[model samples]
Structure formats: structure tokens, C-alpha cells
Target chain A: MTDATPTFERSPDLPPPASTVGVVGWLRQNLFSTWYNTLLTILALWIVWEAVPPVISWAFLTADWAGTSRDDCTSGGACWVFIKEWFGQFIYGRYPIEERWRINFGSIILIVCAATLFFPRFPYKLWVSLFLIFVYPIVAFFLFSGDAFGLEWVETPLWGGLFLTLVIAIVGCVFALPIGIVLALGRRSDMPAVRAVCVAFIELWRGVPLITVLFMASVMFPLFVPEGLTFDKLLRALIGIMLFQAAYLAEVIRGGLQAIPRGQYEGAQALGLSYWKMMILIILPQALKLVIPGIVNSFIALLKDTTLVLIIGLFDFLGMIQAAGTNPDWLGFAVEGYVFAAFVFWVLCFGISRYSLHLERKLHTGH
Target chain B: MAVSSEVGTPPARASFWNDPRIRAIIFQILILGGIILFGIYIVNNTLVNMESRGISSGFDFMGRTAGFDIGMTLIPYDEASSYGRAFFVSLLNTLLVSAIGIFFATILGFIVGIARLSNNWLVSKLAEVYIEIIRNIPLLLQIFFWYFAVLRALPSPRQSFELADTFFLNLRGLFVPKPIFEAGFSAILISFLIGLVAVVFIARWAKRRREATGQQFHTVYVSIGILVGLPFLAGLVTGFPLSWDYPALKGFNFQGGMTLIPELVALTIALSVYTASFIAEVVRSGIQAVSHGQTEAAGSLGLRPGPTLRLVIIPQALRVIIPPLTNQYLNLTKNSSLAAAIAYPDLVLVFAGTALMQTGQAVEIIAITMAVYLTISLVISAIMNWYNKKMALVER
Candidate 1:
């Protein structure tokens, strides 16, 4: 009936495919394979539900959304009115009330420039970046603390909050990079004198914590240099932070430099490239490329470290939150304020990290 | 090359301006001059400023006695103590926190790393959530949260949570019973150490034998047996001399016990959680670096997953993981300095803050603090590097 007798192969084809291959199968295998996993999943969901509802309710529902006064809050939920009232102080610290518009304008300028740099579709990114790198500081300085151009001077002591955080992080990144590169090079240098000095300097900074360095900058740094030749407190702290951060940055860069094939340097030399030319055009371009993710991670770390300046009495983002939360009017909002600051910091740091991962995949040449 | 062997003579074709040696010498002279000038200017200006301010600065403050109170002290401390003693107490506190953080961070990191690679979706996601959240936020903020929001909110000493009548948990700290060892306990300790030495020797001997003869030896089991059994046996033979000093509830608070201050707890927890994220990545990457074929081959030989993991995968993975993990440990230690933010009397807070303020000896104090960290860091790196070299796969 069916070609007489079979060829004696049992089931012939392979056994039926197991139910653990595609999305549904993966869900079954991973999420519900064991009673334990299912239990864990349920527990996790329950935790999320429990935490999120209270948080949402506290932050939004039964909350004071509006009004100019502290009296608006009834306290069942987050008194957003507190955040609203102190929003200016959070943004500009003690920046002169009327003059605060300058920061807004400056932020707008930077935002437009940043849009050019961050979003790939924008044209003339080169010019925009260059403008951002060089010109923005001048405009921001004049607008923010202008004594020149007939605007009243805003002292740095009064200049703080989120603005300070942005300023420090940007300055730290920029100042740290070149100094870090030099230190990294000096560490790897053949010259005994240069190498020894750099080794001493980098190790000295990296060994201690940033908070101590900030303390030194605030109190002791004055004693190090000539007394009459004083730097602004913020400026001194900035320098200290730059130096300390540069030490770490230098080590990271050194790792990248070491990772590059030795032949790359020799090859550049073979092509008769000068030391600077070789570094700028050949060696660094490759070495830096390989270390982009590492560099981003370090930058994220620096951003987080900026909050430490609160110890030195600078009202950076965290400082702003602390000051506001501790004020007599909003005595019990410590949790809310910290959580808010945490959320902002989380968004920024997480964005950079995710972008770095994307870049890792995108720029991956699989050397 | 032999042509350049002419002693004390420049090459015949050398130009004065283009001479590498001369250029180097000139640059060095310029740098030296700049540094010297800068140093002199600073010194002279500082002296003038000091005179103008009518302030005389010296280390005289140290001998005058430190007029401050340190809440927790591992040493005998009083108002009569010198500033030096106070600084030491703080430094010890810092070391204690760093040590504890490194230990816990490593354990949590390993667990989370393994979890990240788990077939179970929920576990992996949880690990991811822990890492991404902790790593992104500033450590300072986390410390602040633990100190200000969490710890500060706990009930006062009056309503302190009691456990077993020997401990108390309040906003202040966790009070647990401390062991008071009898003088004769030294005999037990000495014997325990001897047991450790013997176990190490046995391990080495067993390893050599196994290598030479291709025979399996249960070294781990034997070592564990020696570690625990020998210690217990010694203690029993030495009259079982250790006893617990249970903290009595006295007045409003627990009188005496091993108190873990809230600041210390917060700092250690923050450090552990933050560094664990980095360590998790390191562990994950290291395990992933091993080739699938190695595991597959071992499996085909009828070896189980546990044996295959240990004999084939972990050995190779460790070579990759150890280097990065060491870096994370170093980072955790360094990050512990942030304890100053929450006023946890670590080296930075105590010496860098209180001591430096008293001494006004910025250079000396900073140099000392830096040196301590440098010593700790170098020791750790040196040990880890040596271990990494030893564990590196010896490939054909």
C-alpha cells in the first residue's frame, strides 16, 4: 500500500522540536520553567507594585501642584509647591534674582549648541562643536557673572546649584583630558626625571579621596601658593578636582595606550611622523577610539563625584537639594528631594552609559 | 653601532642648535628655573601674608591636647589624648570600613555576575536593575540617603529595638554581643595558625603528587577539615576559653557591645553596592571570554556541569577576571573616602578634616594621608598582580 515495506528507518526525521526556541518558548523556559522562577517573578512584580504605587501617590496624587506659597501643601503627598518655590534657588543658587535670566539665556545657547553635537542629523557639527568648545564659555561667563559689558558682577560664592555641577563637570572633562594625556605619556616616558616626577604626582593625587582634595583646595591650597595670589574658592576647588580627576583619567588613558599594539608606535616612527604628529594623527586617534567606552564610564564617574563638592560648601545639584530640604519650611522632604536628585543624576548617567554601549557596538571594528 | 663607541665625543655631523642632548639640557634648565621661581614666589608671599594677618602657625597645637570628642574609638582615647592619637583612631576606622566593604562587595559582585548570566529572566533583570541604579547615582547621595533619611528616621534610644536582651538596634547603631577571650585563648589561636600552616603545606604536597601521578586528591575537603576541625579541637583541649560579653540594657541605651555605627554601616553598604556593579561586569566578561568548545569537549567526556565549570571554565575565566576585579577592589577602597560627606570618621574626615584643621600642616598631613593610601594600594596591587601571574593559563 505504501511502497510495501519501509526502509527500516525508525522515525526517519529528527524528533519534534522542543518548546524552548522562540519568544514564547523563551518565556516559558526562562520565566516559568521552575516554580521557583515563577515565584520570584511574582514576588518582583509585587515589589514593583507595592513600591511604585506609594511613590506615584506621594509624588503626584493628593499633592500640591500649584500656588506661590508654602501654605498650599497639605502633606498627604509630596508638596511639589516646595520644589516649585525653590526651583530658582535650585537652578541658580543665590544668583541675583533679576539677573538670573542670563543663565536661562546661556542655557538656551548651550542647548542649541548641544543639540548640534548630540543629535547626528544636525548639519555643520564641526563648526557647532568648535563654537561650543571655545565661544560658549565667553558668552556664558559674560552673561552669568558679567562685570564687563556693563552688567553687574555676580560673585562665584553666589554662583552655584545645578549650574555649578554643569560647570565643574564640563571643566573637569576638558581640563582633565589634556593633562591626563600628558601625565599618561610622562608615566610611560623613557626619561627618568620626567617619569619619576609624573609617577609621584599621579600617584599622590589618585591615592587620596576627592573630598580631602576639595578640603585642601578650600583651606590648605591657600597656604601652598602665595597668600596674596589667591584663587576663588570655586576656582581652587575646580583646579583641585581637575588635578585629582586627571590622575584617574591618566591611568585610564594609560591603559588604552598600553593596549595599542607596540607596532602602531613603531609603524608611525617608520613613516617618519614627528612625536606630536604621530600622537595626534596616528597613535592617539586609534588608542582613544579603543578607549571611548572607558572614557565615557570615567566621565560618568566624574559627574557623580561632582556632588561631593557639597562638603566644601559649594551648592552643586546635591547641595541645592540638601539646602532646600533642610530649610525650616520643608523639613521633612529629605527623602523626596534626594530621590528627585537621584532621578536626575540617574537619567544623565544612565543615558551616557547606554550611549556608550551603543557606541561600542557601532564603532566596533573587532580588532 | 660600533662607530658610535667614541667616548665623550659628539657625532661629527652634530649641529649645536639641533643637538638632542643640548636641547634636552636647555628644556630641563627652563623647567627647573620655572619651578624654582614659582616656589620662591609662593614662599615669600605666604610669609608676608602671615605677618599681615598677625597669625603665627606651627605644630604647637598638637601638644596642647585635642579638645574634641570622637564617638567611637578602638583605642584608649580621652580629652588628654594628643591630636596624633585622634588621627590614628580615624585612620583605623577608615581601614575597617574599606576592609568590610571589599569583602562584601566581592561576594555580592560574584553572585550578581552569575545571576546576570542565568537562564532565569527575573534573576538577570534584577541584577541588571541593581547595577544600573546603583552605578548611575553618586555615592555621596547614597551615603546622604542612609544617614539623613534612613538612619535619622529610626526611633531614638528610648524606643530602641531589642533583640535577645543582648543587643539593641536604634538610629545610633546595631549593638551585638562581643566576645571576651580568656588569656589562655592564645594557646588555641597558636594551634589554629599551626593548623593553617599544615594545611597549606599539605595542599602544596598534594598538588605536586597529583601533577606527578595524575591522581585526584580532595585537597579542599582536607583543608576545610583542618581549618575548622583543628581550631575546634584545639579550643576544646585548651578548656574552651572564649566567652561572650552580652551588652546589658542600661538606662536608655545598650551599655556595652560591639556597636556598628550607622555611619559605618551606611558607608560600607554604599561602597559594596556601588563597586559590586563594576565587579559584576568584570566577572561576566571573564566567564564569557572562555571558548564554548572547552566546555563542550569537557561535557562530551561525560563530565557534569559543576565539574566542567570548575575544571575547564573557571580556571580560564579567573585569568581574565582577577585583573579587573582587583581594580574594582582598589576603587572600592578609594571610594570609601567619600565617608567624609556623611561624617563617618574615616581617615579623610578625622585626619584630613579635624587633624589638618588643628595642625595647619597641609603639606605634611596630605602627604601622610596620601602615603597611607599609596601603601595600601601598592600592597593590594602587588599581591593581586602576583596572583594574576600565577593563575594565568600556561598555554602551549
Candidate 2:
């Protein structure tokens, strides 16, 4: 051995142990390896230092956490005071200032209904949800627009801000899912006529920008209808958003439909299952599970797209910020208002994204 | 088994639409009739309405002189210019914003995507924060923030910040040196083109040699050398035919260097930042989609990390990346239309909002605007699809 009879000191095929290999090793290799990496580290740190403190200061630190008026905001930070004062309007819109409890109750019902649908342990869940879904719109209508029950009528125009956005998005999602499923199936049908019609319908809506559709609904929709017929601008915009969103939702569902094996489709046919029977009994349940993440993604997009209504003269959260910031007294508060609005948007979208991830994990099919 | 019974037909029936396809033909006839009737009704109503209003319509109005001052234009445009020219100017602005946005977004997105995959805790978390914060917010809101809140707060023009004695920055815009080419410039350009072709040929030859002889040629180094050398050589031969025209200080605003408005800058930056978060996700997924086995196999063959990434990983990962990357590019382009909200003179604002109102040609204006977007989307999709098919998985 000492004479060195070609003793092979073969290189190991892999890296060393955890101490020399994984995360710690990666840090040494990536972050502090060279003059350039060290320089990058310092520059990145400087960027954080420059951007974060001011954001934190404006968002929370030295910010007025509680106040009812702009006058009460003595600190040189965000006037969350304005948000606090207008919080009622933001959530319930212009539902008469005195009758805000009606909206509060309606929201409570919505929350309880949502909790029941999401909670697997809840008893008679589907029946309860079905019952609640059917009842709530009527209940909410009477509670919010109360002319029928000797309460004051709250016009749809009075609905604005977060309340309108949430109602529109949630309602749109609820309506679009079923329509999307139908359209997806139509798109996949063997009949060329049916497929062509579905394709044209979906593509035509998808091709035009959402803002134009909203404009068309707001301005041109009335002309399209018969004389003496009137439509609420808010309702029209909501419909426009729903129709546009449904097309995208159909594509997402189609992806899920395609994922089911042909063997399963053949098996369903062998079992003599009718088209509707095979679909509802087997295919749809499985496909919806597969594409829950896609649906949620579309939902997030629709939620963001709802802000386009701001351009059409509706006061969503963003529009509210824009309108409120332009006030005489709060003339220079555009930055603060926009920042607050952005945070609200970021939180809602981020929350949905996190849920989508959790749902994906829970429903993992192991691609 | 019960197919015949469900169809309420005799056993061994071959056709679903068996009865001379009467149901199908009837349905088709109804559809065609309804469509034709609807078209006629719309046409008749529009004609009657136009005549009643005593307004003429057509492309004739497009050639009519547009009498409005546009704040920005890429080419020489005046108030007396045709509406068609105004439309083109607006389209140019939109293209400028979209092109610049796509370029920066791709760069930032890839960096952030790689950052997210890093083992370093700070970097991954920072990337997560960036994506969540930037992507969730409405793009329209960000544009407004840049236009009204950020850029609007800059100091006045009189206190403009000067840079390198050839550029100026103010609330109005950032002005940089604009080149006024002399006669020799075209000669240099020709030399540059020749150099580019030579480098490509050299690269191909070097690659063939490397494959045949198993010897490294450093194609990248050679190409860079030729590219730089030829350009410099041409410049010298042409008597160094380039000079910068400094943006001289004037009474109110800086004069001369190509002036870029705050609106354009704001729109570009906001679109890039907003779109990057999404592109980052696409890039991250594309990288992750490439199985780790490929990289490990490359490393085992004695390839260094850089070469492993460049030669083994990127080519494969890009096959996955290009599809979604194209999507983000399309989204960014479409989202650039929102610049109109901030008065960025994008096609949407100038053509759809302003020109429509001026001409009262809602149908025509909207159609043209929609056609432009549709054309862009289709062309991009077609090119991307072709590339995607070429890169698609082959079982063999």
C-alpha cells in the first residue's frame, strides 16, 4: 500500500453529510461566497432598511390606532382616523347611517352560513346550506332594502365599497360555478354545433377587456333592452363581471375534466350510466376536487377585477379611496389612502391564496 | 346496456341522430334564422338612429384632421394631424410601456423566482413578501399611487436634479441625452450587423467542432470579442461618429434630451413591478417542474454548478417556462391598458376614452381597440403555441 499500487481515491458520487451539505452549506455557497454576494447582501439589507421602517411607521408605529375624526389624528402618520370614521360606509355602504344593524345582522348570517358550509363536522350540512342559500337573498333583501316590511327602501345605488365588492364577488362565484360546468361540458361535447356555440360564447366575452364590458353594461345595456325597462348600474356591472369570470372558470374546470382517466369514462359508459348520471354521480365530484385550486385562483382574479367598476362610477374600496382622497380637507392624503386600500386588497388575496394552498394539500392527488 | 331504452329507440340502433337528423336540422335552421334576423334588426335600428341624429359614420372621419394637442408623441405630431396619427401615437406609447415592462419584469421575475427557491431563509421570505404584496393589490391602484402620490410629490422643475451633465430629473419627467446621428453612423451600424453575423457563424462552427472533437471552444468569449471589437473598430474608422446632446437648463424646463413624462415612467415601473410577482411564480414553477434527477446526473458527470444549471437545467426548464412566461407577458400587455386611469396616454385612454367621445363613434372605436388587443393576443398565442409544440415531450 505504501508503494502506491494504483490505490483509487475515487471521488464520492454525492455531496458530504448535512453539516457540509444542505442548508448551512448552501448559505455559505450562496450568500457569503464571494465579494459580489457579500456586496449583494449589503445592498439588499440597505434596501430593506430604507423601505421597511417608513412603511411600518406609516402603517402601524406612531399611527393613530383609534380615532373617530381627522382632528383626532395628532400623530404624523396614516390617518386611520378617516378609515375609522368611514368604516361604517366602507362595510355597509350608504345603508342609512341609523339602520346599520340590519347590515350587521345580515353579515352575521352570511358568516354563520359560510362556517357551516366549510365545517365538515356540521350536521345536516348540505340541507342546512341549501336552506340557508335559498333563504339569505330574500332575508338580506328585506333587511337591507326594507320597503316591503315597513322599513325604508335602501337603493342598490347606495350599496358601495367593501360591502358591494364582497357581495358581488361572492355572488358572482356562486353563480358562475354551475354555469362554468355547463359551458365546459358543452365545449367538450361531440356535437360540433354545441361545441362551436360554447367556444364562441366563451371566447367572445374573454377577448374583450372587462372595462369595455362594464361600460357596455352601464351605458349601452339599456339601449339593448326594450323601452321603459330600467336596470340598476350596480346590477349590470355585477352581471358583466360574472359573465366574464364564468368564461375563465370554464377553462379551469375543463382542465380538471381532462385529468380524469379514459378508463373511468369507459367504465361509466360500460355501467350504462347516462351522460348526466355519469357526470353528476362520478365525474363532476372528482373533477371539482381536482380543480379547487384553479377555481380559487379564478376567484382571486375576479376579486381583483371587481375594482374595475371604480372606473365605471362605482365606489368600491379603491374608488372610495380615490374619491375620499380628493376631498378639500384631505387633499394630500392620496398616498395614505392608496396604501391602505392596497393593504386591504393584499390581505384578501393573500388569505385566499393561503387557503388555496391548504386545500391543495388536503386534496392532493399526487400528480 | 340501457342506451336504446333511454333513447326510446329499437334495439341495434346505430345513430343517435337517427331520424334523418331532423332534430339537428331543425335546431340548425332555428339558429341561423335567429342569427340572421338579429343581425338585420341591429343594422336597421343603427341606420335609422344614425339618420335621425343626422350623423355620418365610417373610416372617413379617421383621415380627418385631428385638432387637439397631445401631451406626448413618439413622432412629430401636431393638433392639425389626422386622428389616425393621434391613434398611432397613442399606440406607440402603449407599446413602449408594454415592451419596457416585459423586459424588466422578466429579469426581476427570474431573480425573485430563484430567490424563492434559495435555502437562505431571508431571501425566500423576502421573495414571498414581494410576490404577496405586489401581486394581490389591484394594478390600477398601483398606477394611481405612482402617478398621483409618488411622482406628483417630486420637487418642481426649477430644482431639477442634474445627472452627468447630460440628464435632468424633475416632477415633470426624467430627461436623458438623445443621440443626433451624423453621416458616419450608418456605416458603423452596417459593421455591427456584419460583426453579429460573423459571431453567429463562429458560434455554430465552434459548437460543431466541440461536438466532433470533444474540445471546448469558448464560443461565448469569442462571440463577445468579435461583437465588441468590430463595433469599436468601425467607430474608430468612421472617426468616432457619436456625440451626446446634453439636456441644457432652460428658463422653466430642461430643453432637448429626449423627455420622458412622469406618467410614462410611472406606468412602466408600476406595470413591471405588478407583473413581476406573477412572472416570478411562473418561473418558480417552471424551475421546480424540472426533476432533480437531471441536475444530479449532470453534476455526477463532472459538470460544475454553473455549467450544470446553464447546460442541463435551463434548456429543459425553459421548455416549461416559456408557456407561462408568455402568459405573464400577455397579461402585462393587457394590464398596461390600465395606464389610462393615470392619464398615461396609452391606447385605451386616448383611443377608447378620448377619441370615442370626440367622434361619438362608440361602435367603431371600441371595435378597433378590441381588434388591436385581439390581434396582439392571437399572434402571441400562435407563436408561443408553435414554440411549445416544438418543445413538447417526445416518448421516443
- Top model number, TM-score: 1
- CA error at residue A20 for candidate 1, angstroms: 5.0
Q: Interface RMSD for each candidate model? A: 2.4, 2.6
Which candidate gets the maximum lDDT versus the true structure?
A: 1
The number of the candidate with the highest DockQ is 1
Give the runs in model 1 whose Cα sits over 4 Å from its true position: A1-24, A34-77, A119-123, A259-267, A365-367, B1-12, B43-64, B162-167
Candidate 2 lDDT tens digits, A124-237: 888877767788878887987788877788888787778888877888887888889988988897767778877987877776678777766675555444445578888888
- Summing lDDT over every window of 10 consecutive residues in candidate 2 chain B, give the lowest-scoring window: B46-55
Sliding window of 10 residues with minimal summed lDDT for model 1 chain A? A219-228
Error of 1 at B228 (Å): 1.8
Q: Give candidate 2's whole-model lDDT.
A: 0.82
Residue B49's lDDT within candidate 1 is: 66
lDDT of 2 by residue, B286-384 (tens): 899899999999989999999999998988899989988988888888888887777788788888877777887766777788788777777888999
* Clash-forming residue pairs, model 2: none
For model 2 the interface RMSD, in Å, equals: 2.6
TM-score of each: 0.91, 0.90
